[model samples]
Target: MAAQQPSEKILVVDAQADSAKLIVLQLQEAGFAAVWARDGEAAIGMLDGDDYSLALLDIRLPKANGIEVLSHIRESGKDTAAIMMTAHGNENLAVECMKAGCVDYLSKPFAMDDMLQRVMRAMTNRRVLLQKQRLEQEKDDFVSMLSHDMKNPLTAVIGSIDIIREGRLGTVNQEQAEYLHAAIDSCNEVIAMIDNLLDIHRFEAGRMQMKIAAYSAVEILRGGTRRFTRIAEHDGIRLRERLSHETPRIAVDKNAFSRVIANLLANSVKFTPEGGEIVVSCRCLKGAEVPWTRLPSYVTVPDGFAEKDCFVQVSIRDTGSGIPPDDLGRIFERYVQSRSGVGRERGGAGLGLAFCKMAVESCGGIIWVESEAGLGSIFVILLPCYLNGTECTGK
Candidate 1:
């Protein structure tokens, strides 16, 4: 392996001019880029002007002192590691400095080797943290680029398939039409997967913005179920809904909410055996009536809704092979799938539930699943109701 490169820029702070110069020289000789500050005020000023990997500070300094400088650094939320130099023998002062966010400390008249070692260790840690952040950013960029590039071609292919299916391109025989339909379905699945990947990438990077508006809860439920009715019938399954007439309007990103419901329906359609039954239901309930244990970790009840009298509860229940007990806890996690044979037979990218979880939580809702092997599974979603004439408070 190639030798690691040293690239940390360090700041050395001391009231004594000679001590500061000596430390800067030592750091330079050790292959570190170092800047010297004769007082805490100068150190603070330098920090604001430049990015640094670490700061070496003396506890005794003219004007502002080391503790005050460290406190300011912490308050500013800069990720620079700090090592304090203290001549005071009191352990309490050392503890106080640590509580003030000092990463390590040194005593006056410390050996050059020990000081250099501490500096190296702190810089190494900073390098690791920076590397992690960079990798995460790169991953996000890759996913975004891939999704954008694939979408155009996929859309073109789907449009062409639609044209052919409509008999616009000469007459197609039954066999040819069947194969073309399969190809179209496969293309659509790939498009859905790409969309899911993009959604997850945006969500994790905190770029997802909710376009909230008032919408009827019953209409949403009916629309979602309607889209899957024909597909369920083709598979010899029954898709139905039990929405309450008194269901209130909900303010949410209509597209996102619809996507969540579609994903749930897709999951149920995929796993439910032929002739199985699926039900989509919605009802208004009090926050206190929600089963908190069924809520996933990502979902949170908004503070504004805590005192409210009502919330919306939606459930998609299926009578099919249920999830195994061991896999229940992880079904909502990205790329996780049940180990049951059914999941293996019905192949997917395993992102539907994860996307559902994120979309629901973004609207200040909770989603969870209750399943038992060989019985059935019930996926539940709880959303805060949008009272008429009142503005919704969450996004």
Candidate 2:
């Protein structure tokens, strides 16, 4: 790490003029903004309102020891790195100093050059830690604002619109009902986008813990189809299910799988022209029969997976304008929308598919899509069967 920048401040707390004064002089000469405190009380006073990147203190002080000063700084929530200097034969105090939150415990007779190097490294590390903390706080604030300020109000608006359309408030004409439904659908799209953004952030940060359980693949498909039925009807699209007669149970995170289904359906609805058809289907197959070998590396299954492992395959096929073959490989990446200009105009942050991909993969499943320009697309997911399986219907 480089030396602390001139803008960064350091606090030196030691009564010994021989070492403390020389160290302070060297720090300032090395371009660091340094302060001198003759005792522990002075050090704490200096830290009250000012911000310092690092603090160097002596283990034996007049008023308070280095440990006490360090503890006070921590208790007050001050962000500063502490490096304690101990007496020459005070090896026993090394562990105590460290336990009190010192970044480095050094002996009195240490080389000035070595001390400078350690200070520089400590400052660098402290800055990096503070940066990470700021980023995490920003992420939390963003998600909270989206959920409370944006999604909540829009959700209430949608509910009121639904009530009116359902004729609870009064009788409504067909056109009025259609308009209200369209408005509701648009609000739903915004909510889904917000959810995708939050989930994407969590997944990237490795904070999305999946609770795997056996779920009925057929039930999940039916539920998703029901959710988009109204929107599809409004768009003149046919949302049909070609589910199998036998239901297959697959190990997955229920919420994650639901999001995947919703996202795929939304993408289909947005890109499909009027009169287009989308088919939601489920099938169970032997791992060897899944055509997994033909899929790209993005949809890689566990290497331990064998042909004997039974897998459940869920597919959402849309008869809309398909994705360009060249862009198929990268669509699952974050912030990547449709290759066609039409997708851009339709409005999306390009996080839905990426979230779906991660959610599926996190459950030890593989997701892939097959498409060509001018042809419709089919998004497919294959999850390891939870042993209990039933025969699946083919499309």
Candidate 3:
């Protein structure tokens, strides 16, 4: 049961002045502040000017009806709960009012005790709704605070590991160097996890602002893929890229674009086994060639872009264990991971792909994946080409 508020208010709207007075007297005696309205129009005017926890609306009223007032309240997004007061034969009308968002209804000639009980119940439900909203807000604030506090210490640890791996303090033997390198890698992984946590919070809170500008798609893809070459080679995997010179520049947040590419490459590297090959490729595509329906829900196109606009497509294809059909649909959701054993073995907090999806979508692009179990996966990113007055022909 929801908690009760002692200062709750109720509005009583009745065409009969006597009925309205009696109802208001009963509500006031029940410890609720009661206000009276002679008809539906007056009730609506009062509702617009004041905040009432519940409204007791009579079906029969002068000038306007209870149902019409209820519709206006709903359309205005008021949080007030409502109960309809109907005559004995108006059961059908009461049902219709309930369907139109009335919380409860009382028949005419109802006992004062029953009226008070219904009022209390409606107020309690409203209290519960407000409480739930407050709790959700608190939870988001707590997560933001925790993620921010974790970054400072993790940054210092990453810096120390970098120093040791680079031999800034002294010379080190081959075995020692290998151990240091592993330590550095582990530290970097922790830092990445911390960054993902922060980014997810910012994305959900709408605080992740993007610095949009025109940038070469080729340069972004090449630079992003180049960072992972040493890691791929170390794992005995072949990494290559194929870029089309005809690809146009894309308007996006440079840092966010880089992070999106990094996350995709990291995901591919984690799943691809030894002797596997991963290819990063880019090309131009006409809007007709793009499959909008197949795109994940996190991806959204900008409003002005249409089916005739030109786009640049970047694909990362890997020879790795692909996702199971069931998990593929939810792969980009926050904190969701594949149920496959591979996901369990390759541990993550499952925010990498989610971040990539949000970052790409923030730039008015789409990200999607195509995969079959044991046949490897292909991840694609489609971004709007910067046309700049020249007609884009997907050259």
| Leading candidate by TM-score | 1
Candidate 3 matches the true fold with a TM-score of 0.74
C-alpha lDDT score of every prediction, in listed order: 0.83, 0.85, 0.84
Q: What is the lDDT of candidate 3?
A: 0.84
Tens-place lDDT digits, model 1, residues 1-395: 12235556889999888888999988888777898998989999999998788899888889878888899889999988999998858557867898878888888888998998888777777779889989988997788777778877988998999899878999988878767876776787788788888898889979988898788878988998888887788678999889998987887789989888888898888888898999999998876786666565544566765666678889999997899988888888999988877647768998988899899888777788888987879999877778783543333
Worst ten in a row by lDDT for model 1: 1-10
Instruction: For model 3, name the residue pairs that clash.
Output: none
TM agreement with the true structure for every prediction: 0.83, 0.75, 0.74
| Better structure of 2 and 3 per TM-score | 2
Model 3, 1-395: lDDT tens digits are 24335568888999898878998887777777898999888988999999888889998888889999899889989889999999999999999999999999999889988888888878878889889989978977777665667666766877887787678888777878777776766666666777777787888878888898888889998997888897788778999999998888888899989888988998898888899999999998888888776766545566756554688999999998899988887989888887756536767888889998888888878788899988899999888788663445454
- Candidate 2 structure lDDT: 0.85
Alpha carbon lDDT at 301, candidate 3: 64
Mind giving the per-residue lDDT tens digits that candidate 2 earns over 1-395?
Answer: 34556779999999887778899888998889997999998888899869989999888888887888999988989888899888888877877777778788778888989999988889878989999999989989989799899999998999899999999999999999888988987898899899989888888878888898888889888889999998888789999998885646887888889889999999998888898999999987875586755787666666665444577889999988889877888899889986775456679989899999889988877889998777789999887766444322231
Off by more than 4 A, model 2 = 1-21, 28-52, 55-132, 306-308, 388-395
RMSD to the hidden true structure, all candidates? 4.2, 6.5, 5.3
